[model samples]
Target chain A: MDQNYSTIGRSSRTKQAIEINKVLRNTYLLLAMTLLFSGLTASISMMMNMPPMTYLISVIGGMVIAMFVLPRFAHSTAGIGIVFLITGLLGFGLGPILSMYASVPNGSNIIMLSLGGTGVIFMGLSAYVLATRKDFSFLGGFLMVGFLLVLVAAVANIFLAIPAMSLMISAVVIMLMSGFILHDTSRIIHGGETNYILATIGLYMTIFNIFISLLQILGIMGGDD
Target chain B: MDWMKIVAALALIMFIVYLFPRARHMMENSPKGSSADWMGFVVPILVIVLFVMLLVQLV
Candidate 1:
């Protein structure tokens, strides 16, 4: 009787693990699709010749709305609303990329190069986390500090229009977003986040920021306007 | 190739990912399940199709 009960317990645990794995897999797949959609939207917007000033204003508005609304309402729609809002925000954020690409020669090539670089960094950092299985939760606070500093620098640079400051911000963003990928993935593996939608969104934001920053760096380095 | 098609496809992908887990769990727990039990198949296919279409458009 005890043996039968033990077998049942083990099977139940196995079933739970499988369910968690399914959630993780689904989240990664969805994240990939979101990135693709964001890319396509950006490309299309550029092709359509949207004004950069309007795009910048929309991005700012989107960020404000997302920050205020998402956390308050995320659980209401079983997280579906947050997912939709993220997708829309990402699409809108891609506007600057589209505008920059249109303004520069060899824009598509730069975009692709940036995409490839982002993929490489993501894969490398993710593999390091997975192989080591080290908890990076400690980095969370540090990452937040870095993010705030970058935000301040970015706002200041807007008025200064200093090229060196832009490069510094882009470099810092690349590093910060990489740290985020490590921290976010560790959360998923450790079961810190059970909801795959939330997990995917976190990971997707990290990837998006990394790609955008890398593209900016490339533009500054090699772009011919 | 057009923006509308891309947007529509993305929306469909979002819907599928949103629905798949519940659908899968429901099917697994249902007694009268048919060959349609493999509903999860649609999610990955939609993802792949959209991915391919995006790449093609990019090129």
Candidate 2:
């Protein structure tokens, strides 16, 4: 009976590992596709010299899709389309920012630097979580609270119009998003997150925020426009 | 009246206060992260720093 129990436990563990791996694989594949779609739309928006109003529209559209459409389709095959639409819209929003940055002195360099920094951070944090197999679920509450604080601060800073405060907000966002990457990736590894679409969205948002935050900081520090 | 700013400030302060207890709880329940985990965390920091350095050079 003891031997049978041990065998059962081992088998369950193996099955759990397999399930986690499958989810991770699917999440990554979908994430890559969504990111590409987003980039393509962003490039198009850039080429078209889209206005700031486009940014506002894209933000609202992406938020609506994420809040309503994505959740409704998260478990279905349609989730893929919804994910693409959300990411593509967000990417479209990036056009004005990218254009603004591109017009700055040495703007292209800053953009490239921000993009590289974002990629490095995402890959490094993700690899760390995967390699360590460390459960970062404990960070869930901390991240939620952190996010709330940051959001409030961000809104407040807009009226305050304090440069220093804006810089600090950007820095805090970088840390928060980095932590999220770890937490979200660990969730996939530990079977806490099973839906590939949801997982992709989580990771994508984290990456998006990180990139934007980095760009803001870099632009403020080095931009001449 | 600037009620919006006042309400936002109050909410922000309350949230900040709430973080203390939540942080304490988080610390107590934190997982045992290994060296590899630490390395992973540091990678992003280093990348950010490196890019900042690059940007500073341009300036």
Specify the poorest-scoring 10-residue window by lDDT in model 1 chain A.
Answer: A53-62
Candidate 1 C-alpha lDDT tens digits along B1-59: 24533443343344345445544554454334233422322232344334323433443
What's the residue-level lDDT of A4 in candidate 2?
Answer: 100
Q: Each model: TM-score of chain B? A: 0.50, 0.63
Model 2 CAPRI rating: incorrect
User: Model 2 over residues A36-145: C-alpha lDDT tens digits?
Assistant: 89999999999999986677668667866786678889999999999999999999999999999988788898889888878878887888778888777766666766
lDDT of 1: 0.64
TM-score for each predicted model, relative to the true structure: 0.70, 0.82
lDDT of model 2 at residue A5? 100
Can you give the DockQ of every candidate in the order shown?
0.02, 0.18
lDDT at position A25, candidate 1: 84
DockQ of predicted candidate 1: 0.02
- Note the chain A TM-score of all models in turn: 0.85, 0.96
Residue-level lDDT tens digits of model 1 in A12-127 = 98887787677678778878777777677766666667665545544544454455566676565545656665666667658765577756786777678767767866777677
